[model samples]
Target: MKEFLTDPHQIERESMRIIQGHLQLDWTEQELKIVERCIHTSGDPSLEPVIRIHSQAIEAGLEALKRGALVITDVEMVRAGIAKKQLAQLGSTVECFLSDFQVAAQAAEWGITRSMAALRMNKERLKGAIVAIGNAPTALLEVLELAKDPQTRPALIVGIPVGFVGAKESKDLLWEEHQELPSITILGNRGGSPLAATCVNALIYLAVKREI
Candidate 1:
């Protein structure tokens, strides 16, 4: 990683080479050089490397906040309560809320997309419906309603757990609360998290790009 960071140009060249070699795609020497150069000048080492967020980090962040310390948490921490706990521990009068609203919003958007596709039977004709459960019962209901129609049903149902809160309620909502729609042929909960929703959104983007 350090070597790649220091010589990003080399990294890019190596990456392109690997990609081209594996895919049997031809690339001009000049194009490869250009890509390498672009990689090198992209940024400086002092800039922080991206990190995946996790629950432990959130706990740490919460602990920090409790200490009345100025807290800086990564995206993963935002969803976790570490920063909040830290603040509470310190007795600091400061009130702060860490949120990965971007991620949440993205999930919501994907839910909307899924709902739309399910409603229109778009997935049946195009890709296929794969329903994934989320943390929010209300949100799940919304998605289900959107997907419901006379002719189309979801091909798959994924029950992905979202974070620590609302898991049971969300599950109940998906399983027991809502009326089963005829359009949904498959139903299975993945028991993961909202992370699955994020992944689904990313998959959509990839699919679109691949088409383009």
Candidate 2:
């Protein structure tokens, strides 16, 4: 146990333990994993992470992914964060269009973030997939728009895009505009690639084997 003292994640582990012991909150095992990972990623155990899942969306997301559903990410960092090898065992793949030429062209033409354009361009491909957006608020907005079309109904939307501009507003709109859709967002302007990727990884871990 000598290594535990210097482990980078030790503080995060202790913080979660304290929260779990002090709070009477009735979070499930899976939910607690998300919360702890969020805290670990952000280094703020006090940051109340928002979990807006409904009607067993967590279970649904895991099941959909296990059934070979596509996992689309707004940034390559998110794709990199996920345990793709474990996901591949279920015949699933991680996709990120940050480098797509069409996405860049579309974003430039519309004066929007390429991440948003990536979401827009993949409307058809998004259906029945799990979308995780962690960088641009515009990407969350575009997902909401595409979600309106019956053909673009994603299994779940993990919208924790981080920024000072339009981040909080975009997340609020996700709840206001599409409350019926299953979603998880880091409320306020306090989200990032790490938090978004953590949420996706949590869901994937439910159905896939992983090394801690």
Candidate 3:
């Protein structure tokens, strides 16, 4: 039998220390926190090179959280993984519209994915909100369309959907063409709900300067 750290806090501290030691980036403290969280969630030190953060993304997310921005996630799993207690403390709210009746109707009507339809149906709600897309590349693509109208743009986009299909391309487009948009993303198809949610929670903690 093998023994390991049993205390959650101790385990987290050890994990962070290990991640920090492995990270080779020159990212700022806040940016490093986001990357640390992603690597921690994925349990992959190799993620150090693939993780990308827009210069202003951390600040944008923090400011929005401080202002009680709405948080919109592409899937229920991402929404469920967010730190609700921290969000409540910040006076922010998190929501996933994928299961909403209107979103479903729009999806069927447009012959699009529910993820895409959810973004279209809630474009208005995206304004200045923090958006997290962890499961569907289509949703990330759809949000990029809505972002063309600057007034409807999200404050920060955590676009890290996991898949072998359009996921890598969607994130690539986000980084290359959407330089004006503040965002954090993985360069490859190596992201998921927990990774996306952890990025949001990292921002929440950074917003309050609370110790993780």
Steric clashes per prediction: 25, 0, 0
User: Which portions of model 1 show Cα errors greater than 4 Å?
Assistant: 1-128, 134-138, 178-190, 194-212
Lowest lDDT 10-residue stretch of candidate 2 = 46-55
For all candidates in order, the CA lDDT equals 0.33, 0.80, 0.93
Ranking by TM-score: 3, 2, 1
Report the poorest 10 consecutive residues by lDDT, candidate 1: 44-53
1-212, model 2: which lDDT tens digit per residue?
35545674676567667666643456777776777667667767566545455546687688788899999999999888987877888899999988987777888998988888888877899998999988889889889889888899898999888889999999989866777888888788888888888888877777875424
State how far residue 18 of model 1 sits from its true place (Å): 37
Q: Compare candidates 1 and 3 on lDDT and give the better one.
A: 3
Model 3 per-residue lDDT tens digits across residues 8-46: 999999999988999887988788888888888988989
lDDT over C-alpha atoms for residue 173 of model 3:
98
Error of 2 at 112 (Å): 2.7
**Reference-based TM-score, model 1:** 0.26
User: Quick one: best lDDT, which candidate?
Assistant: 3
Best by TM-score: 3
Can you list the residue pairs that collide in candidate 3? none
